[model samples]
Target chain A: MSDRTDPPGRRSTGKLIVSYTIVGVPLLYGLVATAIKASQLFT
Target chain B: MGVTQLLDRERTVAPPGYNRWLIPPAALAIHLSIGQVYAFSVFKNPLVERFGSSETAVAVVFSLAIAVLGLSAAFLGPWMERNGPRKAMVLSAVCFSGGFLVSALGVAAGQLWVVYLGYGLLGGIGLGIGYISPVSTLIKWFPDRPGLSTGLAIMGFGGGAFIASAVSDRLLRTLAPEPTAAIAPAFVVLGLAYLLLMTYGAWLVKVPPPGYAPGGYDPAEDETGVEARDITADQAIRTHQFWLVWVVLFTNVTAGIGILEQASPMIQDFFDQVDASAAAGYVGLLSIANMLGRFVWSSSSDYVGRRPVYAMYLGVGAVAVLTVILIGASSLAVFVLGTGLLISFYGGGFATVPAYLKDLFGSHQVGAIHGRLLTAWSAAGVAGPLIINILTESQRRGGAEGAAAYRPSLFVVVAMLAIGFVANLFVRPLAEGASDEDIGRRHRAEPAGSPG
Candidate 1:
């Protein structure tokens, strides 16, 4: 029964961008490393 | 915003029409970052040479960290429940990543004790908190599919090594190739990176409001035949079901750990023709199997029911281990397939347990209860390696050569699994009665806010 509109902070687009960026950096690293390793496997 | 304000649960409650899918990535962000603990093996050779210590001494660092992880999670579960996920996550981020930073400084100074305190003690605590931080919140957001929802997040923990293995190796090589000098700077970089990543998970994570359920699902009609009783972590420990699940997790993890710890060596020892490189590749394949099983098997557990899924995990896992012992040396396919299935169940076991807890005890403090149960993981982590390492060494001394050296040890694991299977069989559902939350609700009579 506690349903209401989304809270104030969650509304900000900037917050989403920042969170994505933080997670994105490591994910990008992981992807690049995978790509390099995969290329080696093929070559 | 204030620190507490930023982490406040009321603020994190999902809005009407909010997509539940977004929550898993938030969990993944934390789990994957913390999951890098599995990839700590990449640093082994370097640490041995740097501290001028034996490999066993260096391994103590990893073992200590895992031990502390379980300990802190058990103790900190309630505190986290009180503060909510975002706060716990931020705190975990600081401790986990900060442990690396502190350990880096220790390495730079050539102080092994400092490394233990930072990486082992501090970072381990961070890992425990980061792990449980998102779980309760995720369950709240996706009550309709507890197994699958938790699986998606927990699978990230399994997959963490896949990402970390390649990346950590590259980071180590680029920043400081010399094993002795490389560890400190590499730790610094990884620590900072994880700090950022875990913080993102902290920021992104949210809990659902009281009585929240996804659209189109009625909790009352959705019958898993489980009582809607809320049990606190303290109350849960009093139940036989909790200990049964504990033993189940302990035995399953022990079996899996024995295989994992011995992965590369076991394959090589079993067959003379397979070289180290091939064994390494095989280990990688097992890693893939392990990661996939987390998602596939655990998600499937939703439909299959928690107890049967575990029965399958322990029962089939025993068979697979037995198969490896029986004809693994003679046939490579049998060895890989058996070990692969075992590995999948290993990952599956970890992923499925949270949902299993939700089924037995209501979601009301499921996170705290899950945290308490992880002590089984710590015990198994130690016990598994000890059984594998000691028995194999004893066999080697006894002149049981090659694959024969491993048989005695593997059989011991099978015995352990048989006990677990029995434990799984006896895991009776909790009696339909007043749970702790109900008692508290009646006593204090605060309209019970649904346990997140």
Candidate 2:
């Protein structure tokens, strides 16, 4: 049912980037922090 | 329009040219926020100290949260299917954040029961609703790649705890020199922060327009041919396939949580050189594996098909445990790697089930089906720990030490995984006739525009 002829315009693209960033940063932060703690295993 | 009108499913339908990719992030926001429940253990000692209460009393708060999460999800699944994710997300935000604020007050007032009412009862409802909110919508949006879509969202659930664990420690350290004093204000801050993030999720989430599908995907040509029928939640429960998958999940979770519940102490029991700090690192490694596996294995299911992928999760996972039983004491690396592999499978099992349900029963009510299936998790949450603890304790009482103390429990886990592998084999595609009729009956019963 989506209108494929009408592509998501510039503002929509910007919103996508911001939306991903909002969730992405925190997840990345968690991964990095957990990785740091996990590094203790090798030590 | 009023707020009620704004939150309705009709208002939340995807507009022309809206990128389907936006939905995963919105899904992630809700998952990440409610996934904080995984880190509730961080509060146990502090609360115990604050209330001058026993450790078991503090622990009951978590048990209640998980129990209520399962019960509420099962009971509310129909409501969620009817109302749509945006409304559910808003309600989830209110309950989850409000749980924290109310618990904060309870902490200040020294009422353990009030904390139980707030965090346990209210927040558990938040966990239940927020969990299923985005699932069926994601399936509708990504009909061709249900595994990948659901994985992207559920992976957030596994990862949320790591962020929350770190955040809680930092806040507790900074807010008050005495950690006990910090519990109240910390809850307030966390509640407010999660409310903001979850509100963003509520605002952004949208249901796919009716009959929406991704641009290039075709269901008739789908290689697996698993997305066969639109089965209602009630109809789904009556099918043998449903119970088989339920058994599959229950056994898989029971096996994995055996290691998880005993991770820290078990590592030391196995390896003499390992200390508490190193044990903590091992637990962290498992957490990383758990989080990563949710994404990796579930995404792989999109390619390989759900049944085969779950076969790998249980079958290969059993071998991973066997590796620990055979050579684990000989090498620290072997023990960590083997258990870590099994835990990854465990995480994958959790992430993959929603998509699996979608494949078997269709997306119409997959979220509700998924909600009902989580009772397996709730059951395993109890059964897994009890099995491991009782066996390990009895072993210690019988004069066993080192890995010997845990060997019996480890064997039990291997058997559980083997059972799950068998259950996974028994799962068949839903039978054709009854489901089609049920769909017709259910549709007529439903009002127009209902998700189901």
* Backbone atom clashes (below 3 Å) for every candidate: 0, 0
> Can you tell me which runs of candidate 2 are displaced by over 4 Å?
A1-7, B223-228, B433-435, B438-452
Model 1 Cα displacement at B413 (Å)?
1.4
Candidate 1 TM-score to native: 0.90
Error of 2 at B34 (Å): 1.1
TM-score of chain B of each: 0.94, 0.96
Q: B67 in model 1: Cα distance from truth in Å?
A: 1.0
Q: i-RMS, every candidate?
A: 4.7, 2.0
Lowest-sum lDDT 10-residue window in model 1 chain B: B443-452
How accurate locally is residue B66 in candidate 2, as Cα lDDT from 0 to 100? Answer: 90
**Residue range with the least summed lDDT across 10 consecutive positions in model 2 chain B:** B443-452
